[model samples]
Target: MLYPNGWFAVCLSSSLKPGRLRTVAFMGNELLVYRTRSGRVRVIEPHCPHLGAHFGYGGKVDGENLVCPFHGLVFGPNGVCIGAGRSRTPPRAKLDEWLVQERAGAVLVWRHNKGKAPDWEVPDSNMAGFSAAQEACFELKGYSYYGPENTADATHFMQVHHLTDVAMSHEIRQHQMEVNLTASWFGWQIKVRMINYGVGCAYAESELPAWGLFMKSYSFGTPIAPLKWTYTLLDSTHVRWLDALPRVLRWPPQALVGALMHWLTVKEIRKDFRIWNHRRHVNDPKLMQGEMHIAAFRRWMMQFYLRD
Candidate 1:
């Protein structure tokens, strides 16, 4: 199984400024991701269509076009070679384009075997009400589909995340999964609700009613190559009482909680990296009755891959 056919995040939206270009590794190949002068992100094949120079090396963004390093050929947002050096007129060449979109402050590219068009769209959340995302990225030694399966495994949370008195339930809808849970952590009763979108992305919200604190987190896992992937997490917190406080005092507490949430979340997820980095997936797993959801999740994931 190579990288499965689905949407995988390529990079952070904030990383690509206007007229910035980057060489990104995605789905076992190299892609050129660039933002135009007007701030539109485009993902394309990394080579100059005419001479075959990799754009990641010396590629430059000219206004709304991407300039080739070799012959200064220009490619527009549609990946068409619209400008060639000198007065020879643009050649009948075009760079290949990939389906990409920005959501929750990250760029997601839809990938499929044999270049098939995407069948579904990723759902959006209400991020406008939250603060700016506190982010972290990790280069993991393991592959993905592993990240999403964790939602169904409860025993590991107790051993890995150190949970106490946890109850969880799930609602599945084809490519999407909603998980709601109530847990007791260090005497605080917390409620968490998460939406897992395909194998690549997850959006989660944590609520502390007594403290009037709400936290949101977006997680993405992107495959860089075989048996390796990149994991990114962005977290933000909103304190309900902040709005009642003075303007000067409103944001500080919220920002402080956001920062702390980011730190603690990152710390907890790092514990799983130790296991995920070294674990292997077995086609036929030995499962207990309590782990039935893990098996169901694996069955659900098969739809994301191309079939024979």
Candidate 2:
């Protein structure tokens, strides 16, 4: 069973077609999804409870409700039985309502025994920052724990892709600050100034949380157990390199920075993608104890995975 106690991405927002149903597996169960005539989204048991017929392949939306193709049974978005087969006997009040929400241009469904929604809000990223944002899906030939662990494994940032001057090298010694607790914040800012091994030095803050490795990230897995990831690059170096470099370059201002930054970032990302593709579900010395980001990110992950 997938998403045993959390939300999982099922499909991109563009996959849902009006009046057409799609069967998806979540929380170890099959859910039938379809858009109503009024464009409302609905989820229900994939098989018709009356006779075990697949609902997704032949289902239709009637007004704001979803109707079974086999028996013409109708269900509301709340999973209430609004009507069945033209019978006015008042539908049963015992239907189950599934939890579904949209985040990062994708539609997610939560399957749980408690049937509750998450209180945390997904960050609203400035989608226009990237020079290009393309959606493509790839398979992970391994287990989820490995994928989660990769987010904190920074040593590879340099070794695997030959990326130098990453965030890991900006170590702050004798800079002791206690971890702060917060109830919640729809937005946040992080500030840090340090002498680093990168091109000169800079100060930056981002809305995305620093989780071991990935800040702004997205991933999903099916109940059948394969996982996939679609990474979006924000502000590529080719797009902002020269401005990012601490000192003015010796060449044309825009020409040097934009072209150089984008080229380097794209080259590094392609290398990382190749490394990521070959790593299925292997456990390695990806991280060690006392690593700065792992513990914090694990806690954050738990908050999302275990929240009622």
Highest TM-score scorer: 1
Stretches off by above 4 angstroms in model 2 are 1-4, 86-94, 112-116, 128-132, 169-290, 295-308
Clashing pairs in 2: 142-280, 151-213, 237-261, 237-262, 238-261, 238-262, 242-257
lDDT of prediction 1: 0.84
What is candidate 2's lDDT per residue for 1-308, written digit by digit as tens? 12334455566666787776787654335677777777666666677666666777777777777667776777676666667776756445434556667655556565544666555333334533232322434344333333343444455544764434445322322211122212112233222222111110111222223321111223343333445333323231123333355444522544444354445545655665666657653323265654655554443334334435
lDDT tens digits, residues 1-308, model 1? 66787888899998999988888888778998889998888998898879899988888998888888888888887778888777558888988888899988889999877777877777667766467789888889777888888877777777888888878888889888877778877778899888788889988899988888899888999999888899999888888888788867777777888888788888899999999999987889999878766877888888877553
Candidate lDDT values, in order: 0.84, 0.46
The TM-score obtained by model 2 is 0.60
Task: Give the worst 10-residue stretch by lDDT in candidate 1.
Answer: 121-130
Model 1 regions more than 4 Å off = none
